[model samples]
Every structure is written in structure tokens, then in C-alpha cells.
Target: MFRRFALAGFAAALLFLSTTPVVAAGLDAASINDAAAPPTRLPDRQQLSPSIARLEILLDRAHFSPGEIDGKFGENAQKALAAFAEANGLSFDKAVTADLWTRLVAASEGAAVVTYTIVDADVKGPFLNKVPVKMESMKDLPALNYTSPREALAEKFHMSEALLQALNPGQKFDKPGDSIAVANVLDTEKPAPVARIEVDKTRQTLRTFDAAGKLIAFYPATVGSTEKPTPSGTLKVTAINKNPTYHYNPKYKFKGVKSKRPFTIKPGPNNPVGVVWINLSGEGYGIHGTGNPGKISKAESHGCVRLTNWDALRVAAGVAKGTPVAFVESSR
Candidate 1:
């Protein structure tokens, strides 16, 4: 139960925003790290707020991912915050209360943003000039690398490409030895082993549990669409494939794919299955990563559950071959 691919349409928009000083000037590390509790009502969708960005980074650090940290208090961010609040016994009524903020900050380690020195690896690319929009065209490419250094660094730190540019105005990501402020979300330590996983279709979320049934991690996810609904009941992990090559089955008859023949897509971050694919017992169904990190939870998948590349990697690292994966149809 996986989509052949979902084209992320935000690249051009992010590239355009990178050049706009006004947009990038609106926030910085100081603003983000020192951000106060947000107002009762969230910021407008169009408005980028440092407070929300801080909130997102904190939530991410706490193992409750907000998907892409775009500095916007959108549904994904709200969902993460609400989940965090519920876990901490704080009542969230669509507001960032002082109690919730205090709890989040206390639970999270390190500042929301920190200085990162760009290394040669960060700037060096075998970078793709452009990724193909169509899945069929993508199969021929050598590798599905990030389109730019900004994209690479942004993904590494679990921040949006636009947010990375916004934090370091006028700083081109092309050079090594340059320093920039980025989200302090590098998970250096290994995650706790997961005994079980729950995919809440209604909530568009994935939650992992420890052997003692304690929540280990939570992530916003893109569930299946009406066209290809996710499987019900429970499944078990069959395998964990890192940097997996995407194999397409013509039998799926995925929309927009004209080829009646099966094909294979090369492995990379932007591959259809992304950095990691946690195979499930159900055929073609597993929780995996997405090329379009920004569109996660906001868009629908073909059938399989989709999380951010980083989150997927973390989840893959945490779960064993036989971990139980339950797909809950509703909140109950």
C-alpha cells in the first residue's frame, strides 16, 4: 500500500523565498530560541513565526515530530503540539499556554536553534539540478540526491529549506566552513527499541511504544486516500530497507503512470520510498518516508503510511523484524 510517488511542488516556491530578504529577515535564532508562549490563536498560515518554529523544534526533540519545520503554525505543527500537550497532561484548547510551553521546554534538551558549520559534505553535491515530476522519468536517474545544499542541510537538521535560508539571509549554502543557525535536532543517540507501533488513520499519526507500553516516539503521517485505503487489523515488520530502491508493480495501476510494466527507481533521499522503508506483512504496505516532507499529513498517500525521512529512519532504527504494527481506523 504505497504510492508510486508524490511530487513535492514546494521547491520553486522555497527557492524564490530564499532570495527575498524581507521574508528571511523576519526571524532568526535569537528570536526562535527566546520565543515566548504563542497567543491563543495560532499565527496566520501565510505568516512565519519564530515562536511556532521554536515550538516545532522542541516537539521534534521530544520525539513528537511536526513533520517539516517551516516556521508556520499550520495543522501539522498544531497536531504535534497537541500531541505533546496530551502526553504531558496539559490541556490544549488550540493555544500555547505558559504551562505547555514550560513543559515542552523542560522536556526538550538544548536550544531550539544552534550554530552549524557547513562542511564539505554539506556543500558537495553530486546534486541533482532538478528532480523529475513524473515517477516514470525518475527511474532512469543515477541517484535521487537533494537538489541543493540548502535542501541537504535542511533535511539533515529537520528544518524546512525555506527556514534554513530564512535563518541565514544572504548566505549561500554553496561554500564550506561557513556557519549558519539551524535547528538543533541532530539525533546522535540511538532510539529506544520499539515493541509496538500504532498507525492512527483518523489522526494521521504514527506512535511507537516501548516493551512496557510507554510511548517512545510519535510522528505526523500521510495516511492513505479514498482511492487506495490503508489495510486494517495488525501487521508485523517483515524487513527494514535503508535507501531502498522503489519497485513498481504495474498491477497497482497507480494514477498518472502510463506504463503497464513494472520498473525500479534508484535509491536516495528523494526516491519514491525515501531514505528508509519499513516493510510490513501486508503486501505493498508499510510505514515509510516521503520525498515531499513538507506535504506530509497535508496530503494523502496511495495506501502506505508516510512520514518525514528523518522520522522514518528513526522509526526503522527502533523497530525489530517482528514488531507489531496496528492500524487503527479511528481515535477509539
Candidate 2:
């Protein structure tokens, strides 16, 4: 299922919004025709199509992450908008009506993407030569860090390594102080302090809402599995740790570990938990980032909600202490 939501009117809305571009976030203020204003002269579906990339960026700006922006109007984009609509209390009325268009333009306030010069710090890595696949091997590493400059750069931009490569096109990200194109993404305009988090296992998504009950941001998530199911009911957020160390306890007896002694994996971007850990009241269960963003929700988690590192950071930045978290089988 694309989602648990009824798809009855979605086809019409998507068909028109799949092949054109809307006003970009980066266009000159005058040319953009009141980007800060309610949308006027609303764009046709074709115009909305090419805006997929921009839409993805804007949704991301507002913290409704569309995962990796592929510049294609597909499931992720549709889901993103649906999430946005649901958060803002808009009706999915079989089309991208003026209200929705206006809201989107208002949210997406800057250039869809822009150029970034790679800095010394960005390329400077005591980078790992390779990342091991198993916890046993990973425990022995000096740091659970990214294996290369390109990988770091991609994660920094909340992009897929592959997509980043395609954008650069034969340009090696190996050098510091080099210029590269990056999503002129939204700044750290964190949403109003998060009041709660909802993890919809059926759709494999995580959403954050404010005290006003407005959706602040949402992201694709890999919740726990049939074999290692997540805790049911509500859990409170207990703590949040950034660049967390991975502790492999022999007690858990995960498949590949030969050692009975406990060991810790040093912190880095590739750490099993990615960069941030949003610990929940459910013991050993929380929402955290993953080394494999490309596989999010495509795979089951070991009883936690897994988001991309950047997405996790985005989530972490907005939430505060003791927020309520609910794990539910959502109808949508």
C-alpha cells in the first residue's frame, strides 16, 4: 500500500502535479511573485510536477522530510504532502487546490538548492578505510566513521550518496575547500517545541507535532519488526544522545559476535545509531538515525525507529525533554 489512506482522489492530484515546475525557492524575490504571500495564479499540475524537487526541499525546510529528493513525483513526495496536509488540517480534495499551493509556497521560502564550497573541515576526516558489516568487527574499530569524503558530504546535505555523486558528476569530493552543489535546503528553523511524536508502524513513518497540534515535521522511519516488535502504546522520551557510542552486550547474543565480553563502538557518522539517539521510556527502544538511509522502512529495525542521520538530527533538533511518543498501527 502506498499508504493506509484511501487513494481514491490521489490519482487525479498526482497526475497533474507530476511534470512541471512551480516557482523555485531561490528565484529573485520579484520574479517569485509573492513567495511570502498566499499563492496567487496557482500553478497547474504540470507546473507542480517539476516542482517536485523544490517541493521536497520545501517540505524538508518545514521539517516534513521527503527522504532523499530524487526530483521525481513519486510515493515519497505524495506521502510528504499528505503528511503536510494532515498536520495542517487541509483536505486532500482530489487536487492541489490554491490553499495547499499557497501553504507549500509559504513554507518553501528559499532556493530549492544552491552551491556549497567544500571546506577543510568537511573533507578532513580521520575517515575509516572501510566500515565493517558485523558488530563483532565493528567493535574493534577506532571510530565508527564514514569511509570517505563523499559519504560525509552526502550525509551533511541529507542526500543519498548516489544522488550526491550524480549531482557532482565525476567530481571527486575528496578535496577540502572545493566547491560543490548542495541542496539550498532550509536552515535550522526548528519547529515549535515538539509536544509529541507519533510512529505509524503500518506506514513506517515518524511524525512530530507541536503543542498546537499542528504537524511540525515528519520522516520515513523503520520501526521494529515482527520478530522484534516495538513496544506498543505510549512511551515518553527519556533522553537524547548525539554521536552515540554503540555498546554490544554479550547478553543480547546478536548473531555475529564471538566475544562474551562487552565492547563499545566509537562514535562517528556510521555508528549503528547514526548521529543522534532519541531514547524513549520504552527500555532499549528509541528513534535514531541509520547508516543505511537508502534502506529505511524497506527493512525492519531491531525494535527502534530508524531515520536517516540528517533526518534524525532534524527530528532531534526540534524535540524537547519528556515529549510523549506513541507507537500505533495507524489507519493512514
Per-candidate Cα RMSD to the true structure, in Å, reads 6.5, 9.2
Question: Which ranges of candidate 1 are over 4 A from the true structure?
Answer: 1-26
lDDT of 1 at 191: 91
Candidate 1 to native Cα RMSD, angstroms? 6.5
How displaced is residue 199 in candidate 2, in Å?
1.2
Q: Using Cα atoms with residue i matched to residue i, what is each candidate's TM-score against the true structure?
A: 0.92, 0.79
Model 1's TM-score against the true structure = 0.92
TM-score of 2: 0.79
> Which pairs of residues clash in candidate 1, taking residues 3 or more apart in a chain or in different chains?
1-284, 1-285, 1-304
Q: What is the C-alpha lDDT of each candidate?
A: 0.84, 0.69
Please give, for residues 100-187, the per-residue lDDT of candidate 1 as tens digits: 9889888756677777778999887899989898999998999999999999999998888778876776778888977778888877
Clash number for each model = 3, 11
Deviation (Å) of 30 in candidate 1: 0.8
Worst 10 residues of 2 by lDDT: 1-10
Q: What value does the lDDT take at residue 328 in candidate 1? A: 94
User: Per-residue lDDT tens digits of candidate 2, residues 1-332?
Assistant: 00111111101112212332332223321222223321334344323222455566677776778776554444555677778887678975335566776787676555555567778887778888888888778877888878888888877777655445544546688777666655556365444678888999888898888888867778988888876789889999888899899877677655556788998888887888989999998767889998887677778887889998888887788777789999889775
